[model samples]
Target: MLRIILLAVALCLGPIAGAAQQTVDQPSSTIAVEDSAERDAAIAVRIRNILAELEGYEDVTVAVTSGIVTLRGTTVDQALAERLTGLVARVENVVAIENEVRQTTDVVEQLDPAVERFLDRFRQFVTYLPLALVALTAFVLVVSLGFVIARMKRPWDRLAPNPFIADLYRQVVRLAFVIAGLVVALDILNASALLSTILGAAGIVGLAIGFAVRDTVENFIASIMLSIRQPFRPNDTVEIEGDIGKVIRLTSRATILLSFDGNHIRIPNATVFKSRIVNYSRNDERRFVVDLGVAYDTDLVEAQALALETVRNLPFVLKAPAPSVWIEALGDSAVTLRVAAWIAQRETSHPAARGEAYRLCLAAMNAAGIEMPGPTYTIIGAPASAPQQAASPAPAPRQPAKAPQNQDLEAQDVGVQAEDELDEMISQERQEQADHDLLSSAAPEE
Candidate 1:
């Protein structure tokens, strides 16, 4: 034990004593009265002492004669060799310095110093192990505390508008704690200045990533906005960029829709946020139009009146905003008329109401002997083999199809309500991704 103690003490004090070892003793004051030989000896001793305290100078030898100093032997490199001159010149009474030191080329000689440096660093690391451990423990504790706070759900959920936003909040909290922990660790290690270097590098990397994924970043931001201010709610019937569908849910990366044909359509949130959206379900009452053409020879006034009466009498058509009928345009062989009426689309489908109105109007027109002719073509010149002078008799009155006896003028709710298959599909999709879905039906529409 005594020997071990002695060895440990030596290990601690060995290099320090070697560095502190007395240099060649200098002469006393009253150097002004000394001769050139005395002053030269003093200068040599002073330069020698300075070199003794430093590394890579053990091979150097210093000499002074007539107030002129000369440094001899080898050092680590030419730069250190040049440094000896400035060091020697600072000594009292030294007139000039000659740097005669050369950098050693011997492999063993060079490797010796490098090995010593490595050993010295290893010793320093060993000495700091306990303190480094303490700093590491502190960092871990701080980061763990942050994770605990971030894992909490109630606060994040209450603060955010939707699940996606709540998850974002948690991630932000975790990241903030990580940075705080880093700062605390660096401060404990007495390396706080290094924190700026770490953050700078992180910023540079983050900027590069942002540029590489500009579109993704845009979609993320759009998702946030969408989650906050819900442009359209779940199950809303909307037409976007000519694709009509019921909204399923909004996710961080895309807006999902259940198309009419039951296929899933995924559009990037960036595009959805930028495109024009036409929401058909915003109002309960919707108007539908159906076009019919009557032969030009038929009375346009009577055709319009009969069609208007037929549509207004239908059970589904709204009476307040009365049904309207008007001449739309003149076709090649007929006069086109447009019939429009309003219905409560929630109860009656727009397509069903429009088709029923068309069928009934055609029946009424045919029953009244009003001809709705097909497209007809005529040649200006006379026919080669047809008779020249012939006055054709008026066409026979057209007969209508078997009407529903008394109520044949109108069709009941046969196909009034459209199938709810798309709505069911949208509900199923929303359930599948409820965790990431940003949409909320209760949220006020934008």
Candidate 2:
């Protein structure tokens, strides 16, 4: 009976030992599987987090099974789908990627967010309607006050001598008031922050515009200064920066000149304002110069007296200023004398007076037996007969003395005609300007 018990105990212990071994092996396999599954799960979570961080992958989904990742979701486009696959493949535990992401082509889905945003804005606007209305009313009232002030011409009557400058001042005042009103309205709406943004944007835009229209601004400023100074008036004979002409009109952009040939010339106001201006018509009395060449043998004092007498007797010459002649230079052929006389430009045409002076002086010189010398050339080698001929004297030409006619009456007629024409042009321009002003006043404000 002891032997039977020992065998039975051995069989029971063998079965127990085998069962323990099997249990140990099963646990080892199970642990490995669990570790692999956990690793895969961690990798999938990491991939999802990475994709979430990236843009245009909001609808993407990541799944992992046995270390292989599968991306399945609707992407915005094929490019994003490819990008998602590439991102997943870079994960540490990921063996491969099954990219099943599709690009959605539904128009309604694309427009849904935009429509919702617009609705939200509309709701906000409706909620602020009362405040908006009050701000608008305040803006309108302030602008109306600016308009009323601009229209009151009596306040700027002192500036009437320069209408252009006056108009500019009025515009500046109106703009200042309007901007002040705008600031007040914005403050009332609790949008003072917006004012800073608006002002910054306006400054940037204004800088750009200033660069683009720099020349125009300069011309306009010069025009205002010229108007206030009144350097020259209409129909004045002027020489500006080498351009000689009669002033026709002075517009905001340019100074209009009627050239001696009757062509219209437009010089920019900035250039005109910066140049040296010579106004021939500013004074009624103007001096004219004539250079006369007489024979070297003639009496210099007697020739001067004769020229002075002739100029004084002319109708156009001014007696108070007087006519004078002086010996100017001694040349190889003759003696040069300068004859100067002052005349009333208003009563005489300068060109006509100058021409008459030349003719009468030549006649007087001839009648007085004064000779004008011809050019004498010396020969290095010449015949004896040639030298004798050069030295021989010739008879002086005689001219009849005739009384000089008064030409001032003709010049006065021409001046009166020019004045009439200028007045008509000015009147027509004024009428057109008035019509434009009326039309502008009648138009409704924007």
Point to the candidate with the largest lDDT.
1
Each prediction's whole-model lDDT (CA): 0.81, 0.74
Worst 10 residues of 2 by lDDT: 435-444
Per-residue alpha-carbon lDDT of candidate 2 for residues 344-419, written as tens digits (9 for 90 to 100): 8876777767777877787778778788665666547577676444555654654433334432322222133454
Question: What's each prediction's TM-score?
Answer: 0.80, 0.63
lDDT of 2 at 90: 59
Write one digit per residue (lDDT tens) for candidate 1, span 392-413: 7856654423434344664868
TM-score for predicted model 2 compared with the true structure: 0.63
What TM-score does candidate 1 reach?
Answer: 0.80
